[model samples]
Target: MLSVRSKAVASALVVFAATPVSFASAGGFGDLGLGNTDWQVGGFVFVAPKYEGAKEYEVRGAPFIAPTGLDNGTSRVQFRGPDDLRFRVLEFSGFEAGPLVGWRFDRDDNDAARLRGLGDVDGGVVAGGYVAYRGGPVTPFVSYHHQVSGDDTGGLIRFGAEARAPLASGIFVLATLGASYADDEYMDAYFSVTPGQSAASVAGLAVYDAEAGIKDVYFGLTTDVPLSDVWTLKLSGRYSRLVGDASDSPIVEDENQFFGGLGLSYRFNID
Candidate 1:
């Protein structure tokens, strides 16, 4: 069995893989008018339990960078953490859509001692497209990604909605609810235990064949505070629940996971 700390680390990695960091758009309310182009660079630290059922916790640090309104305010781009990146191809009348790309981190024995003999899951590239409609205070979005290079083949679909509101002076709250659907290839790569894997299992885990289905549902909240004209601080928390075959996998220790992080960044604007 995996230790609590190991499980926390794995869970944290999953959170990192699934979520993308984002900053508020320019000319929203403060009206700093920094320029037509806006960008931010910073770093954040987060804590999460390894996987699902592990009792231990893991702490990790990641850099954040997001640049928007690059093409004379017609294009937007963002480097959302280490695992996810996105670019908006066009924006018009509250509708923005574009290409999305990301990398899946590898899972190996180093992640958990209990994973020994299970063989490594090599990281791969994910390519997809997303469409989002920002009408009023609510935004709904959906995306489809295919594994172009990695141990996992097939693809997954992600759909979600987000909303934001002001809490107080210089403070704003953002919330998101989302879920993902995984194909057989993607589910098997992460959750399935093959006969060979069961035979070599050090933890005596039973063979599990994960099927394609709804993988997990997640909810997250983020709060942003502007420390000054050029600096901002962000705090965030999230919860996820595994469902369907993913939760039934013998390798899954817990079905519920939690994550939290804090970040500070310096903003720049170009005219």
Candidate 2:
């Protein structure tokens, strides 16, 4: 478990690195000449063939629940877009930040489990702003994510770099690296297991009160291969490790998660 001091220190490093790159390159939007700002909307659909759980007891913290969230085999659809507005916040660099919104539809067992304890924990919602730097082929940025669900609400801190490499034809490869954090509600909803509740494998072990807040620092790899000028094949894989009090919870002290997905996205550059 990472202490609060450690999390703060890590977050500081991320901010220090990502903010400068993002602010320094915020000016590139002017090249598009799409007015000072524009609106972009896009959607993605994906099929997660298998959403397997590594340990029925530790991963979910509840042995009664199934490992995989998708019991009947399901597909997911999500949508995200931003209004890119460029500003000169930093000295010589350009700054672009916008209001963003996203939605995830398609429910799974994990969704049900979380909802069992709350109002309507079904899918996911993301809202936030991103500041990007306009220098070079690789753009660095820092973004704040406010994700809310029926039962869970948390702030996500992302610090990473992205690169665009030109391929044969007009295609390009987009790469990204980032990490995030979650609050206790995020863990209690999905990972907490209570006594008297049913479990598939283990018993007597209940998640009475998590000793720490839920925190996960994840490393992710994603590639966007152009299918056409406006469409691309999006593939992403993320490996996450639990930290903080959540890691010390009696039910899931040793749980780690690796999740991956494949999807197709239609993107529009409004700016």
Candidate 3:
């Protein structure tokens, strides 16, 4: 049971660069509490491509990030994003630091015809930490993540900023802008094609070696419109543009990627 639940948690991490995992109960009050006053847990559905550059889209759904407030009965606070889940434990003034974990889905060659020779890049656990500063309306953050499981799954450094604004009728919006610098192992697994691979590809791919560089620049926006005290409608959209080594790869069919999702969630507050 523990192992299976662990797999679910890991699977949830692949939401954006994608571990946006969730937890629900089969019985009882139906919400898991993380020792915060405003903890929220809910589910949502989204549409996205199977792989980074692929054009085909699939409809999938998962639970949203159930955030726990970080105020330990003090003045400090915590923040969480879809890809990384960690409660800020260290804080000074407007700055905070904490560990981060995420999941990246494997690129299965069978998922697309163009990837016939590339093989599979095993999805793995991304473990790292983050540092951020809360400056009024905007929060700027930088994080380092490394794949700890699977062979040569690679790693990346992500820098981003988030801001929130409220609209009329209690509607709210969260906006994000970020970029990722992938390591050679990450670039190679997804973009590089070896001589042997080039020959094996049915797409007639050329041999290419992808080096470490900026993988992509991304922008995302999420809006929440309250339908009731316990229910909400969430609409999210994201765009990612592959750059540098990732863009020039032979296997890449599209350099501009997009995903959008609309979910109806029932938010339950922890008592």
Better of 1 and 3 by lDDT: 3
How do the candidates rank by TM-score, highest first?
3, 1, 2
TM-score versus the correct structure, for each prediction: 0.76, 0.49, 0.81
Please write out the lDDT profile of model 2 over residues 6-104, one tens digit for every residue. Answer: 122222222221111111222343332233232222322222211112232211100010011110101111111111112322334444454444432
Give the alpha carbon lDDT tens digit for every residue of 1-271 in model 3. 0011123543344332221222322122323344534545566556666677776766665665554221222222222344465545666788878777766666778767899877778877768888888867788999888878876668888899988776765665667899999998888888899998899898889899999999999998766667787766667788999999898887787899887767655556566
Model 1: residue 90 alpha-carbon error in angstroms? 3.9
Computed on alpha carbons, the lDDT of every model, listed in order, comes to 0.66, 0.38, 0.67
> Candidate 1's residue-wise lDDT over 122-239, tens digit each?
7677788888887777889888887688676678888898776778865666677999898999788878889999899888778889999999998988766778887877677888
Note the residue pairs that clash in candidate 3: 12-19, 13-19, 14-18, 14-19, 15-18
Which of the numbered candidates is closest to the native, going by highest TM-score? 3
Candidate whose lDDT is highest: 3
Query: Which window of ten consecutive residues has the lowest lDDT sum in model 3?
Result: 68-77
